[model samples]
Target: MRKIYFIALLLLCGNLYGQGLPGLGAGTTPNNKPILHGKNWVAITGKPLGATAGAAIFHQGGNAVDAACAMIAATSTMWDVLSWGGETQALIYNPHTKKVIAINALGYAPTGATVDFFKSQGMNNPPQYGPLAATTPGTPGGIMTMLAEYGTMSLEQILKPSMELAKGYPIEAQTANAIEAQKAKIKDWPYSKKIFLPHLGKEREAPEAGEIFVQEDLYQMLSKLVEAERNALKGSKSRKEAIYAAYDRFYKGDIAKEIVRGTREQGGLFTEADLANWKVKIEEPLHVNYKGIDVYKLQEWTQGPALLQSLNILENFDLKTMGYNSANYIHTLYQAMNLAFADRDFYYGDPAYVKSPMKGLLSKEYAKARAKLIGDMNDPKITAGDPYPYQGGTNPYLDILKKNQTKVASLSPGQINSTLDEQFISDFQSGTTSMETADAEGWVVSVTPSGGWIPAVVAGNTGVGLSQRMQSFVLDENLSPYNLPEPGKRPRVTLTPSLALKDGKPLLAFAVQGGDSQDQNLLQFFLNIVEFEMDVQEGTEAPNFNSYQMQSSFGDHEIRPGAIVLRKDTPEWISKELAKKGYSLEFWNKTSGPINAIWFDWKHSTFWGGSSDYGDDYGIAW
Candidate 1:
């Protein structure tokens, strides 16, 4: 099968130059489509089933926020990779209020969770089992928070579409692959396996293009929420009461007991108290100034600080003049990324537990100092800097510059040679997750929910697996001081949803799913639009690159590996130049991070939307 696929690719590659991939053009069937005007909306994701749910909400007179909520609920049913019982972070742009609010729906460690708890358990690090590893899920609270603050539609209206489809949506190849990959874990959870497996009591193969797939338990959960919402609207209870009732129905009622019982049977530590006491936090959004624009990000509980740091470094570069995907542009991006990552490794953590110098790190003076260290157009062998040293609330800058800068060059026209060859395996596996975006009336909503730790958590009533998450923390003795494990502290996360603005107007809504690659993908996508002025599709379809020279939750912590992977579409000359600049290139079939984006074309008065080909879906309507 591998040979057959490779041979087919080679045959296609024979005509790859000038002749693009079959579905690369506009209005491409299935992969790309144009929607009719109806408050101008489009939904794009990693699966068709998820997109259908978003589209249904738009069809139901629900605004983007309503549509986003529906889609998130639906994604849980379609892809176990993103479950409703997980953490979520969103960025909502309210045009009426002229504000972009960041929602931190990330889970927090249980009050009993701590490094010493693990130590007492004969575990050197946080255990993946029981109450110690389970953080209070914030997804439910997040959805409710958004609805109360910005939504005009009731929860019943928003949840109806997903409820109807939860029992089944047309399963596709991608959905099947996702299920099969995690079948071992799924089989352990009776409820999860019942919905995912076939009548033969085995995980089914990838479904054909239009086969129905059902998640009955999940459908029931949605139905209960809808009922609660209706009951709340009758004036018998307050809105908060209705929301909590629905939440309780899931966590403290039958479902909660099922989870607790299952975990206990499996030697896990979740308790009824943990579930009842779990509450999502409504914290302040981390704010920073990037090129005069007030950029709002999720708090450091996730990797939001790294994004701000990247923006700080980028503020000093003239990215517009560097041109799109040019060597100079890419090099500057890498340098900025390197600098941000350095701080991310050393100083980033839950601010409540660790005194992260996030404010000082994002200071303009610190950014300027870091900026001066890089030469104009030459690739440095190694980019190094301190993680924001403090002196009386300010850091001093030292003048450092290199000579012999190279001039930026235009991309040469020809067949671009891709860098993704077969020898690229370095155990650096990054997987696709789930995302949703909606705007009701003028209120915008975005959600990026991911299964960071997989294989340990099953998808259905047997409850979601969690062992993979435990492996995400760093255990280096030297870095042990920074390792995550604290009561009420959120682990460093990578599922990021972002909103971009121009001249104080919401311009772009976007996010990507790829573990540590999340922020890097975000930076590249942002630059593709804001700096290069590319259209939404161009930005989504650009040949992207990422550095493996840094440590991540998934890779070896080494610096001189020189491993870099570029998309198959990157220009050949660019690849050569990169190699000459001391990058060790590893080619791949495709290096993709599922990125979905919506661009507001103010001049045209239309919204252009796209989802990465790296995933299964991207949709739009206007």
Candidate 2:
């Protein structure tokens, strides 16, 4: 009877897939939350207060860009696993241009930061914590640059919410607990201890939930930015010019001096010149057309284009015909992701410092060639594909790559120790937060700002947390030639925001907050809508799998080949079949990131928002 039941279920699923990945209509889908309906504007982010900040901006007649900046400011102030000193990368759909643009505000390695510098310190990679792990602050300049280029609001107006948050806001339990848990590390930094642990030497030094978390220095910093903009406006400068004045103040004036003082005092390598010379790049985003929809992603500095490459590979297969979460479907998606990620791990990096075969990597012909490598089962021994031939160039690193192919170990359930698994996940999927905002004027913004998470070393008395992104770079060129740390190169990071257009109009604007798992989750969330026909809410709550076969962008940059994490509620047969395919299966409570997305309901001329239930992600629409 059990055998008969399984066969009948498979046949029933086959009928469902004949229609495209299975969806049980609207009500039956696993929509943990209701879809936020907005006829004019929508704001969704990793935290509730962050969404509220954006919604307030929209309500105040701010455009999407303005609202997005406001939300970024607010979230940074709230320290939603991010701070004002962290890098900010964004994908914005400018209504005026009718084109998507990329914001590359990622910070560069400060002066004296080099692979040799780390090796000299008896380390293989940069320290995971402390001032030595810091990058030249980018969020300040990035925010100012975006405002000057695209936003209409003044710095004062845009920063009002965050300024208030800095003065004092009721801290949440999650953040408070995070501080308490890392009290030992927090105590290591005197400045961090002064602020993060108000009840010093107490049993619970970190603030309790709902405690007013105040940062006088952070509030003072906000005042400075706003004052600069206000002064520029007083001199009769244009809005853009005034914003740029504030930008100059942050990067070249008193702000930069204090930042250097605070950093160098803690044994950091930042110089005033590093901050002065750094500027955010307003880049032409990369895109690829999948089916009829055009998907845009940040350049090689991010892990975003990996999804585009994955899409190109998956597009060759009729995914709907395979059914969602089935053994074959899971295996196929995982394999394709592995291929794309393999390329990302090796090729994606700072294009300004090293050349990338992006032209060939995104080519459909290359994807077709890669798709051919996927067999009936998991290819644990998958390696990065050579795109040099496709790009009409000779491979320079062929020998080095051959010598560096990562070994895959297929382990049974008992072979996996629970302790090591926890450490592996901790290193694999670190923390970041996302902010997504859209307005009635057809402007959309998706941002994945990260680094400077809690337990961060405070830069002197500035109350500004330094970013730990330096650990993302490798010391050995053979591991990744393009990604070897240099004084001024941006590390290849996992923060990726996404925007998609259908028929040259905004279709979906999305982003998520997970270290290496970002693109993986975003890719699946996008397919859940475009391929499976699930609504935004259902897709946000949809069960997705994670492939941990690629080198993580965090910690020691470890890779766990043949390891695939799935939802705890995954079907028995699917798990059994995947295990038989040589996959080391692990069950997780939530398989994907706290994905937040906005779907433009073109037909109804309204917005549909989806915030995942996996975390504190929240959305508001009006």
Candidate 3:
């Protein structure tokens, strides 16, 4: 019956082939299109196995964190396209504490990486491929950290399904397509090619959709961690201590050594200290009060704040009055997004190195002032604002802000490599995997794990991989405060996950993986629920639009004025109207992103879940 409904929905919705593989489409899809509902819990993830693993945890009486971690492990092992060697960033809501927390699972540049190195190599930006593109492995550590700190289950317990998945899982078409698409690049690294394109007779070919894809090396790696924890348990260590033992085994023990050894040998710069010293920090999420509801985001290190800024600006208008998907709403959204993105490009960076001006950025007064700059018609030029005075407080990052100010490059063709550089940055930026879970216990988890991608050169024989995150770092020494490559400094990343609270209670948890397109897609999802009154699934599948009119978050940072790409099925009248208004309208034939979201109705004490029809998006309720 579910299969029948799924086929019907696909026929009704049309082909989402355009959502493309990992980063191209809306980030949600179903192997079976029937809406999944559960009175106890629900799981939505990038793969069927992920949803299954997460559901198993929930059935076993584990909390949301445990289920989410299990989902991460399963997806990381199976969905090589969305996340392989990727880092993780998550927004988790603890029902007990009633607090929303942000987890920064990303890694920084190795100590030896420097501006001089890229400069000497005649590269204007960090390399988008090979060892230099790789960053320290963070997925394993991040998942383990989440389980250890917030979960009720032990690592050994949560990872059983993942261990089985690692042994072998049938490759789906999307996963197969992703691997085959990168076959040339995979061949560049002997290790990656060996794992992704194992020999079936002499000629290398991508596994057929139903062929069993085995990761024996990855299986061994996971087994060792579980073994480490089991061994520790034999010594009568506490579960927490045993989890730590397993964590150390990856970051400080043999796993770390192998990662460092292979990376350095391949001319990458990771060190033993890089792995040992790295830890995922739990952070207070930055948030804004929007129509009495609080929308949470990660700090300046990610593009999360831009969504808040855009929302704040949009709050001034009655979106419903403008109508759903109306020309006015689209224009207003594009202009507001332009303002927010301009500020994001100028001000968003690692708080440790750059003062993000968060107070001013999220302040209502600042949004008002910035909103005043948006015109009814599209403006192609970049228009960043001054937030220091409007912030209502002294700028804490004054010195670094001044340094950043001096290095600003005027938007020019020379400063922006529109092709090679743009493609590279866009390709590596937010390419990611995502999962969302909600438990009857009131715990909600939204996790987007990215990094270790096809571009990465696998570190030796360790089935473990690294992320192409370092490629997100800019090479301009003059822009040191914002994007200069430095040891121990994490690149200003594009991975942003979101959680929302209404009346001081959890309302929604959602995330997507379109690099810069993430926040834009999410903004629409939020509006669809709050303003348009669409259910979570309808909102998630709604037609979406993204604009590149502002400076991009990565690479040469080009701002393409008036560039707007709408999904093909968007009303032709609306597209024509926007184009008439001097906006460059391009139709994207593929479906947009796979946005995964779970809406919590505290009043009804119920959970609603929705995902895309990309086949990769899987939702399960139990």
Best by lDDT: 2
Best by TM-score: 2
TM-score of each: 0.81, 0.95, 0.89
Per-residue alpha-carbon lDDT of candidate 1 for residues 399-511, written as tens digits (9 for 90 to 100):
11011011102222122222333323332335545554545355666567654233334423633433234434544433323546665566766666777677887677788
Candidate-wise lDDT, in order? 0.61, 0.87, 0.77
Error of 1 at 145 (Å): 2.6
- For model 3 the local lDDT of residue 69 reads 92
**lDDT at 240 for candidate 2?**
94
Report the poorest 10 consecutive residues by lDDT, candidate 2.
411-420
Ranking by TM-score: 2, 3, 1
The pairs that clash in candidate 2 are none
Q: Write the per-residue lDDT of candidate 2 for residues 1-622, one digit (tens) a residue.
A: 9999998787655533333434455435547788999999999987898888888888888888888898888888888988988999999998887989999999999999998889999998888889989888888888888888888888888899999899999999999999999999988888888889999878899999999999998899889888998899999999999989988988899988998998898889999999988889999999999999999999999999999999999999988877877788888999999999999988989999998889989999999999999998777667888888888887788877777663223444454332336767887788788878888888899999988998797876677888989988988777688899998899999999999999899999998888999999999899888988888887788788888888888777777777888888777877899989888888888987799999998889999999889999999999
RMSD of 3: 6.4
Off by over 4 Å in 3: 1-32, 82-84, 200-204, 392-430, 477-480
lDDT of 3 by residue, 312-364 (tens): 99988877767667677888898999889877876777787767678888889
